[model samples]
Structures are given as C-alpha cells and as structure tokens.
Target: MEAFDIAGLCAHPDDAELVMGGTLAREAAAGRKVALVDLTRGESGSRGSPAVRAAEAAEAARVLGASHRESLGLPDSALERTVAHRDVIVSALRRLRPAIVVTQHWDQRHPDHGMASHLVYDACFMSGLRNYRPDLGAAFRPRKVVFATSMTETIEAVPSFVVDITATFETKMRAIRAFASQFSPAAGETVALPFERFQESVELTARRQGQRIGVTFGEGFVTREPVEIDDLLALRGRSI
Candidate 1:
C-alpha cells in the first residue's frame, strides 16, 4: 500500500479542482501526500472528451502538487451506489491507505455528486471491514471524511470550518485553469449550470466563502463529528 496523507474522491475530473483545490494544494505544500480520484470520466459533460478531460486533470493534479490521480472510469451521468460501484472505491481505499478522505456533500444539485458522496461513505466503511471484500486489499479506513459544499451556487448548511486559502488562492486558480476545455467559456456564449461561465461560478463561490470567514479566499468543509479542540486559545481565525 502506498500510504497517502489525504485522498479526495470527486464525481468528475474538475470537481475537486472547482471545490477543494486550494485545500489539496495547501495540504500538499505542508508536506502531506495528497492524491485525487475521479469517479467518472466525465464523458457526459457538455464539452471535452474523456481523453481531453483526463489530460487536463493530470495537469491540474500536477499544478496542485498531488502525488497522483486515478479515475475509476465509472459511466458518466450514471453514478449509482450498487455493490460494483462501491467495490472499486473499496479496493482503492485499501490500496491507497489514506489517513483522511474528502468528497462532495451528500446534498447536491447534481445527482452524480450526491451519489458519489454516498458511494464514498459506504466504501470507507466497507474498506475497514477485514472480512468484507478480502480480495481487494488489507483493511484500512481513513480516520476522517470531509464534505465540500463549494460545488453549488447555494451552500445549504453552515460550514463547520473554512480553510484560509488566501495564500494558495492563486494556485487554486491555476489548477482550475488547467481544465481549459471545461472552465474556459468561449466568446459570445450564454448558457446555464456548468460550462456557462463555470470559471466565474468557482471564483464567486470562493469569494463568498472567504468573506464569511473574513479572509481573502477560503474553502468550507463539513464533518459528521464535532472537531475536538484541546485548547480554545490555540484556535486561530476570528468568528464569522
């Protein structure tokens, strides 16, 4: 097993870059081995072939300093929580052996994003079971799972915490720009949802999250359990 400090499961090639690129970049810069997993090839997207998306993803990973990135090749726009769908992630969890795993929030406008969240949640539990899927690899479960809410225009829930990405905000933009096929809006184009001013969408969301925490740039994350604090005085950043 190639132990990783952090591993993020994304619904598509650019999902992580859009939402948590800064967090990933910051962690990588702090000497943590960060990796990314794209659940689908994004063949169903409006623009960009799978090959083009994969190449862009590779470049984005390089820009973010990720140790590596893998794609499960799951059917695009057809994500499900079936056993087979979950097995691939189970195998990957065992193979990579990450200490922390991050994925999309369960509540999302896109069904695939929600499905990916559930799939990752189940895979994490199953991967820890020694008797379950023994053929995959040794049992290993990440200690923490984080949910990112920056993918959507409306954040429905209050963030548990916001990462101050002020330092790496530009780095995040560079990574987002790597997926030129998707983020680059063509001239004289008016559209909806993704691909229609997608780059602007990402930037606006980041700015909103940053303003909440009184920072130049920020990425918000949610956790199931309360974050334990050993010393209140040691906690940094002001209240929103």
Candidate 2:
C-alpha cells in the first residue's frame, strides 16, 4: 500500500500554512508525507504578483518539508464548483492518492474559501466514482476527509480530530515568514497588518484550540463523516 498521509487543499498560496502549518510541521516531523495543493495562485491577492506568490509558496513548502506543492491556476475569487474544477481536483487526488484529505471549512468570510471547500469535498467524492470524468483516468478514494478551521467567528465546526503541534510551533512560524513578498515590509508591497500581527493571530488561534485539549498548540479539523475509533482512550493525549 502507498504511504502518503495527507493532502492539504486550500484556495490561496498561504491559506494552508495559515490554517494548519503547525499541524503539518508536526506531521512532517513524524515522517508523514504531506502535500499542499493550492486551488489558486492568489493571483488576485491584494499583494504580490503570481511569480512572487509561486516563489513564496515554494519557500514555505521547503521550510515545512512538504512532499509536494502545486497550484491549479484556478481563478482567484472567480472559482466555480463546476465539472472542470472537479475534474482537476479529482485528477490531483488520483495522482497523490493520499490517506487523508484536508480542505477549508464550508463557510467562511471569503467567497473563495467556501467555494474551494465545496469544490474539494465534491471532487473527493467524485474521484471515487468510475463514471465521473473518465478522461481524468482512474478514481481513488481517500480514507478520511477533514476541513480546516475558518477565520470567521459565527460559523460552528466541531472538530473530530486535533493534532498537538506545540513542539513544531516555531517551525510553522519560519514557514509563514518565508513568504517575504507578502509579509515583508517593502515599499511597493501591499500593506498587510504587519507580519507580527498575522503571526499573533496564528498564535492566539493555536493556543485557544490547544487549551481546550490541554496542549500548548494545536490544529483542529472537522470531519465530513462520523469518525470511527477502535479505542476512544487513544484520544486521551489528543483532542476531540
């Protein structure tokens, strides 16, 4: 059997890192294979060009030790959950054949976030069907699928799993910092809330989730289906 563990799907260049970089770093440190697939290049982002974004993504992936990272060239905010979109994602899944697929929450402050979540969810299911978009070649279903935490406060998502990432927290910061074009305070670059501000947000989110599960840092994931556990006690050191 193949050993690839996770494929993180996100809408923009840094979305995956922003949401679950700490967890990803922890997984990679444990020798788990992790790949990042960005639905769009963040081409329409308020800051940085496509080339810069691509470079930043590569740098971040290197820091996180991701097995693979690629962008689908999908329209930034104009992405549609269409057959074309589904086919591309399905094809990617068939190629990666990961054990678990991670994506964004269904509802979010940004339209692309919600659309990307729907697209990834539908594509994962469709990738398992034999008759859907046969031109993409073969279909392979993932063992588990989970969505990342969103930035909005109004949405409710009960996490089915959580990864304690306290040890790799600094590595996650390094990965986020590698996106210099976006976070760097260059004169021509777009004004973000400062790199430190963004990092603080990440720190707060991780600490809040970690507190619930008695950890120093963590990343939460909500499963689309019910999670079956062989032993609930195995979760004693983990989170719900």
Candidate 3:
C-alpha cells in the first residue's frame, strides 16, 4: 500500500486552517504528503457566500501547500451521525490512505463540528472492516487518528502527541489570513469587532497549547490509543 503522511478531516471550511495550519504548513515544507478533507462547505456561515468561501479555501490551501483539499457536501450546520455520512468519509479514507488522520475533538458548541468528529471516528473504525463498505471498492485502516480542538470548550483531550510549529507560526498566520472573506467584514457592517478578531481566538488557543509543551506555537491532538515510537529519542528532537 502506498502510504501518506497526514489527512485532515473537519466540519467547516476553515477548521483545518484554524487548528492545524501551522503543522500542515510545516509538514508540507518538509515534503510530507498532506491532504485536507472538509465534511461541509461552510455554506451556512453567516459571513460569506459559498463561492467566496471556496475561493478562500483554495487560497488557504495554496498557502499551506496541501496536496489535496475537498468537501463531502454534507449539510453545514445540520450534519448527522449516520451510516450515509460514514460511508462518504470511509471512501475518502480508503482513497487517501493516510498514516495519520486528524479531525476535530468532540465539542458541544456546534452540532456540525461535534457530529463531524463522531462520524470521522466511527468511519475510521468502519473503514477498516472489509465487510462494512466492501462495495465501495476497498477498505483502508489508518495507523493512527488525532482530534484537533475546534471550540472554546475545554475538551480535556490529553495529547497522545504534539507537533511543534514554532518556525512556521508566521506562515500559518498568513495562510489563515488568506481567507479574507471570512476574516475581513464587508462595509456598512456595524459589528463591534471584525472577523479577524475572532480568528485570533483560534490563534490564542493554539498558543496556549504551545505554552503547555514549551514551544512558541503548537497544535494539540488526542489519539484513541497511545502512540508508539521506534525510539524514545525521536521525541527528544521535537516538543511532544
């Protein structure tokens, strides 16, 4: 089987960029294959049009140098945890064949984000079963899966691993700012703060995670199982 590095699955348009853009940029800079899959198009967002969001996503992906970025066409805010959704995610997993699958940690704030997490987690398990979705073509089982924090709620996601993206922090922010439609509001909007202020909320959360591990910027992830390594020294080179 041809192995891949990281495949990120999320609910909204910018979830991956908000959570792991730094790590994704760093990984791609290192020549690792990274793919981003969105469960929904953020069509229901109060901010921008779908076409505008799609354009912004493309720009953000280019900034991150992502190998692939696509959406599953699931309902943005009305995502449900069902076999239908699971089948869609399973097909992508089989096709991408990632060594590490990253997604949002379960959060109660938004149903779409939370359901996206549950659906991906279940789909990862179902993807490994040959009998579950055999007619789809082939079944794929990834070695590991990690969940990114997508909400303000403290999910208590004990990190099975961490990636230090301090060197790429500036690049990450630039990539995030590429979604200008989402970050900068249109004129005549009397909102107390611009969208970029909300974007900083994401940055602050990541910075907090970085502080936990003695790094300038980091992304935290929770795995279903403990991460195994060939040598403990592997961790010595990077912040975990």
Best by TM-score: 1
Alpha carbon lDDT at 148, candidate 2: 81
> Cα lDDT of model 1 overall?
0.89
lDDT of 1 by residue, 1-240 (tens): 599999999889989987899999999999999999999999998777789999999999999999989999898899998999999999999999999999998888888999999999999999999999789998998999999978654445678888888888889989988888875456876556564466677777888889888887889999989999999998887764
* Over 4 Å off, model 2: 1-3, 185-192, 237-240
Better of 1 and 3 by lDDT: 1
In the predicted model 1, the residue pairs found to clash are none
Q: What is the Cα-based TM-score of model 3?
A: 0.90
On residues 1-240, what C-alpha lDDT tens digit does candidate 2 reach at each position?
Answer: 343698899999888887788888888888999999999999887767899889999999988889899998889998888988878898888888888888988878888998999999998899999887777767788888888873545575667777788898888888888777776666665654877777888899888777768888888888867778798677576334
In order of appearance, the predictions have TM-scores of: 0.93, 0.92, 0.90
**Best-matching candidate per lDDT:** 1
Q: What is the lDDT, from 0 to 100, of the residue 158 in candidate 3?
A: 58
Model 2 clash pairs are none
In what order do the candidates fall by lDDT, top score first?
1, 2, 3
Q: Which pairs, if any, clash in model 3?
A: none
